[model samples]
Target: MINMQMRNIGIMAHVDAGKTTVSERILFYTGKSRRIGDVDDGTTQMDWMEQEQQRGITIQSAATTCFWHDTHINLIDTPGHVDFTAEVERSLRVLDGAIAVFCAVGGVQPQSETVSRQANKYKVPRIAFINKMDRVGANYQSVLTQIAEKLHLNPLPIQLPIYENDNFAGVIDLITMQYLVFDESTQGATVIKESIPATYLTSAEEARTAMLDSLSTYSEEIINLLLEETPIPEELLISEIRKATVTRQIVPVMMGSALKNKGIQPLLDAITYFLPDPFELGSVAAKKIYKNKSEDIQVIRSESDDFIALIFKIQQDKESGALCYIRVYAGSIKAGTMVLNVGKDKKERIGKLYRMHARTPEQMNELKAGDVGVIQGFKLAQTGDTITNGAPILLESIQFPEPVISIAIEPKTIADMNKLKEVLTILQREDPTFIHKENTETGQLLISGMGELHLDVITTRARDEFKAQFNLGKPQVSYRESVESSSQATETFERPINGKETFAGLTLSVKASERGSGNKVINGLSNNVLPENYQAATIRGIEAALSSGITLGYPCLDVEVTIEDAVYNEDLAHEVAYQSLGAMLTEKIASNASPILLEPIMAVDIEVPNEYVGDVISKLTSRGGIVLGMDMNESIQIIHAQSPLTKMFGYSTELRSQSQGRASFSMKFSHYEKKLS
Candidate 1:
């Protein structure tokens, strides 16, 4: 049971929805921690990074292993900010299931919706937790309605909140028809089960019946029992609910306030009872190649199958140098074994393996198929590399968003240059979306990330961890250039190189691609004329040319290039000349291709008091934002809009002032649109 009993899950939520605090409670309750850790005081176990502690927010995903009811739970706590959404994306890619925490008052916030959509894209089964129920204005019914309307989820309540006036005492289980309350005297350790309180008996019975009726579709036995008015047993109901949960047909909703230390134990029980195990996901899919033919197939999760593990994350441990985290899918992995990184076509040796709890590493000799563990000394393995013992079977890699904001940074002292480069290189390897580059023309070093906080974390680490002081410049939006019209051009490379004239003629066509598709290079020329090696070189050059825009120095995007025809002599043909000509001809074609600038547009969600709704609307209007929709939830107004990133660099500070510190908001990348002149 220790091997297949494991459940790989993540706790996801919006900012300030108590995701970290809930993680601490789970760790403490499951004996992973001696006492609960607080995020506000910077004592949390999951938010262990120095930056996270100082800012009182989670920036990276932390993984840990604990047990409850003889079931091993491998949990990952992910960041809630939109800037660090890639963290959530990668976590969901490997997890078997998730617990999406929603604030009862601020039900279905922006980031909550964003992460929910991310989970849906991966087909991850999840349960809903109505967190912060202890706070005032915690309307459970409103949040449930929003879940159905906004998240498009089929939600069923498994528990009903028992509130004594404004204070939340406990919850009544709808499945077993019992009242369960946490003991405050024992610090929520003792659970007392008794008869349903007289005040909530009517509502509880109605809820229990409704829950059973909805789940009848999953089990024929339950349907027959309900139709016959027979008393259904608890096991029968739970089994049917588990069936629906594993299939992701319905999301079972539970309520709790993690900050108050109430309603955590039941949530843990729900996780063990409902979420899927690695073995239950049946077979893991991987792309395998045989005889130069590739197909997508499933790899069964079993100890008998060949070893397959995916490197989901990479961190630079202070004492261990490089620490790699992997989810074992097919077979067991042990220390002192060699695995091939099928994506890189390189072999890597597993040195020492460890199970990581936050930043702490515990040495382990082996890990089972469903477990998560770490390894070190993988010099060439990247974040998404697939390591396998069998033939080259590559797992589908995680996709990351491109960086849209950048800033120039330079060492304050010349002695810090090498250290700065080394530090940034390590940071780049850790986060795929974090980009590091140097301007050859001006000799300026620049780092690009998703947002201001992302860049701030990089600079702070450079200063604290590496002790490399640096001066940073102002932030700038990373605009893109795109083709606006179809055009054709022919260029003949008849230049003299090394006292020998290298002549090659190439014709190319350019057209505007759909927005958000990035750039593409289509080879319309016959292979006999252009050949394979030269075509590859030309594509590389086209990619290089797209990095610098015609309107400004920004990168180009959403454009397609086609190689119409080319003439080259095999006796004197060189790939190097075509590479240079490719970059050269791309720029020549852009001169008349009607290039246009595109700026990153963000979808913004704001919640403010009704009194400040007018002010918020006026400010967004001045910043070139159109109000997408507005809704009222009690006294607060929810406003959504699409605004260009250029005008939103420092809008947070201004928004706090506009709403008198009562309004808050979050934004995420929506689409890239043409920038107005």
Candidate 2:
């Protein structure tokens, strides 16, 4: 078996920060590739997708494995764009650590801060890389200061750039007191390690002394050694730095230009030296049910424990059909094994196991704990489903944000309509956030997602991959309905023919709750007037009525309904009569319930040049946005605000035009709020 100490790390950064370029350097230096592929020319090995090449941006996360020294590293290169955040979130969930790349010239931009916040939330240990030192106006020290002040990171520089701008030559490794030069003699390739340059010796020593001072706080022994001016063992100091990083106390910042092929070796060394191994992360926490009836709670740890794996992503490949990507939490998973899907309470047999290599799959016989692999032919398995040995265990399901934007779609032809349902069903299964439901009142097939790009990609996938052609109506703003105040009303629908009589009556009161609480129904009828079964049927009818809004035909939320009174004849009453009466009574209540429109609200983060900050804020306010907060670093400002989704349909293009293509923003669903009168 491979060493359990292997760590899976992800390289994440803001767009145009050279994240993909950094990844390419890592691959090249590690001998994974004979020649480095540049992202500018659309020839990067990791960014292999057609859309990525055409758009000059990463659209999906790519995974690859390489060895640094003796430690095996599974690295994932994630897209920096906000549109592909789902990919980043899933990758973060499985990675042990992350390398956050920041452009030295730009410092920490909008997406960089946003992703940093996400990484902090996930409690993932990270190392910061200040890249692009070869670019003009690149100040490594200024960027480090920005990280400390803006990002609230206690950054200690482990490597310093030797020179800046066009004369950029090498980096001084503070830890080992070595100077590493980038050799362009071999086609702008190869990293050469050598002694520190005479001019940089004093600067390197000063930086190393400062690093030791920073480390002193983490250990009293280090402080004492520093105070006595005693020499500290290099290996011991490296071990302490790793411990501090794992504890999230210190972030070792390194500087180099990936474009120049400089500082790549030092960064790799820092990764293998500082990042914690999977075994160091301890066992994956999973709730397991005990065999004894008396005990209900148990926690499983490693492969020696009972087998358990959680499916984090699911995809419907064109040729391979359905594939479920899972992270093994405990024990070993093998082919032809029957695992119980604790979420669905169904047993599925794992037909084959494979390791994902980009879009290709390499067959594997078994996978141990802390490994990520794919299982085929498990039709019942889904993303977030927990698979375990028959022993029952309930794991928390993955939570996704509610979609704020929606589009109404329909088949253009009868042939397309015949296959639309199947295609849509598969799409919904792949992405939980992509909701598809038929509106009972309007009979429109509404599809909702995080934003316009998200829905567009899904529609494109449907047409290209599923071979289904359809017409999409103008993207409509998703509106909701809710009651303003409490109100009560009574209605009766009685049908009698030739002495055969069926009678049903109900009195209901509708009250509005806090925004986003959704609708709640209560049965207040006495047993003497109506049975419990009859009241349940009435609740179902009310649910059906509220699903499609009474006004613009959208769903309703944040309203409460109660059946205050009900009467039914035991001999003459039927279930159909109660259902019909409930429907009629609900419509009657809605007529006087004082329903109001609610629009979808989004949490937006905008990063723009200092000159355009005022313009961005003014435009947001003009569009009815509520500026929550503002953060400024260097020449860029990060504006956090909440705005109506309707106003943001084409804002990307507008923002690019207004800012002269120097600004970018990311927005996600926050919560639904009432529209102003």
Candidate 3:
């Protein structure tokens, strides 16, 4: 059961790797648009947001639909910056395949590795598009090598770039053994296929032989033909390559200057030929919950099956309210259908369905299986929520990285306080990585996000889009608290309830767990020690105390708490008394345990020239950075290092001054480490 007529793919790359440009070219060549959109000119359809257009960087993943010949392509253009990594993550969760675009000049950048790892995590097979072949110092071979070395992906080059006097001319299609030259006069709308030139013929043959040799492992027929010295048919080669790609055995590599539109059409053909269709994916594993019991279930990928869709993205529209972007994995869903949101445990009536084209939407009556569309008027639907008609099936929710940075925000005026709160709620619904919480002790509203840029974008939107007036404080590191050693505490809590006195006694022990294991509660007490009704109440109170942390008021992490014993009076002890006793015991252990403050450490990658390497390293080390490793790619020196997020703040500006604007760096949250006194 395979439908070859549909392809759901995403374009991902490092910042400035030209993924958006590739998307723009796809739109123009697919006849979806008559004019090509330019990123520099701020005319690109995929980057439709005003902030994105002004910054010339994609902040959010944008989805659009277009056609390549008879095949319908549902394409998502994802952001490459580290701040927007969650967008790439959620998109990959639902995508059937992806296109990993790499910069020819800046090969294997930090964000490229991040996105590649994300794609790998979701088991989304992807093809490599060596983009920006026309840039100065562009080397597709170097990029290909880096892709294999850094990403650890089996990259089989299917197209060989042809250069004429150090200028990118065209590409030689290895499968067809033909030259592809896009007509510049027609804005690369006309693809001219010619014979491989004499000078490039040998290289093309070598690449083709290498491709066949790699692909032969997937098909015995191809291996037999290669062994017998029989001419392999294009059909056989393509079929074997597609098979390998679908199984993620090998990534078919293509080279192109996406901006110049030299090799886009062939790339489109590769996407349709290699990427898996929904039917090919078969059923997805999910959990069915009924009567407080859960069982594993498979949601079939067919229109006849029960309806199920994953809400991957949520957008707030001024006139229409919330727009929920969904990937329909099971049966069809129509407007006005009553659906159950499994995560929220609420029922919502589907509003209007939309076939979204960036900011524009075309009304649709139904969203069928294997298709991506938007549903409006969902009051309960949020990102990572699974919606179903009645199956009670819960699909795996998308996991987002924790926010590493925070900023204090306050309404500009007392009248704007409610407006700010309302806007924050809307923003949180749209971005899973964005967190806003009220600090009970300080009474300040704190908004946290993945990075500085992430918070900046959110604050801008709150002020401009939602028209909320808010003042922001300086960025701060979102730290956590953890214990270094085990400790035990016992406490008796007594409170007056109604007209009766209630009493309870609890004993608990706290120990450090493995870093990133997070907080876990273990009930060591036998059922006879504590009644089942009060056990849950005690655990909830202990969890709440752990969330408030020890002394610093930061959330606790990597801590294991065990309830050792509980004593309660039959008539005097109630749920409230037990809950209070649990919290008191946890707080008592916090006083005895050797608690430490944990700061977010970042994995930083800096690319600079050899001459500026010493200066950059000196500056980084002065900020308490540790040099992990370094490598030389072409003439650029890439330094891999780790540093505390607290010290690394505003380091980018300093690095620019030190390297005279030649060095560039990217960092992501690596781990939480103990902070020095």
By lDDT, the best candidate is: 3
1-677: candidate 1 lDDT, tens digit per residue: 35437889999999898999999999989999999899999999999999999999999999999999878899999999988999999999999999999999988888989999999988999989999999989988899999899999988899999989669999999988889888888778788998999989999999988888888867799999988999998887777888899898999999988998888998998998899988888687789966666889988889888899899999987787889889888888889999999888889899999888998888999987988999997999888899999888888889998898999999988898888888999999999999989988888998999998889987898799878788999998888888899888888777767766676668888889988887889987777887888888878887888887755777888888888888887765667677788888888787679988899998989999999999999999899888999978888899999999898888989999998899988887788999887
Residue-wise lDDT of candidate 3 within 1-677, one digit each (tens)? 54348888999999999999999999988988888899999999999999999999999999999998778999999999999999999999999999999989989998998999999998999999999899899888888889889999999999998889988989999989999998888878898999999998898888889888888877899989999999998888888888899999999999889888888999999998888887898679899988778999888899888899999999998999999999999899889999999978899999899988898999999999999999998998889899999768999999999999999999988899898999999999999999999977678999999988889999999998989988899999899999999999778877788878888889899999999888999998777888887888899889988988898889998889999988867888799788777877887797578999999999999999999998899989999999999988888999999999989889889988988898898889999989995
Better of 1 and 3 by TM-score: 3
lDDT (CA) for every model shown?
0.88, 0.81, 0.91
Please tell me which predicted candidate would have the highest TM-score against the true structure.
3
lDDT, model 3: 0.91
Report the error of model 1 at residue 348, Å: 2.2
Model 2 poorest 10 in a row by lDDT? 290-299
Off by over 4 Å in 1: 1-4, 289-293, 494-503
Clashes of each: 0, 2, 0
Q: How well is each residue in 113-191 modelled by candidate 2, as lDDT tens digits?
A: 7678777876788899999888877888888887888788889788877764457888888877888787788644576
**All-Cα superposition RMSD per candidate:** 1.9, 4.7, 1.7
Clashing pairs in 2: 303-331, 518-558
Q: Is candidate 1 or candidate 3 better by lDDT?
A: 3
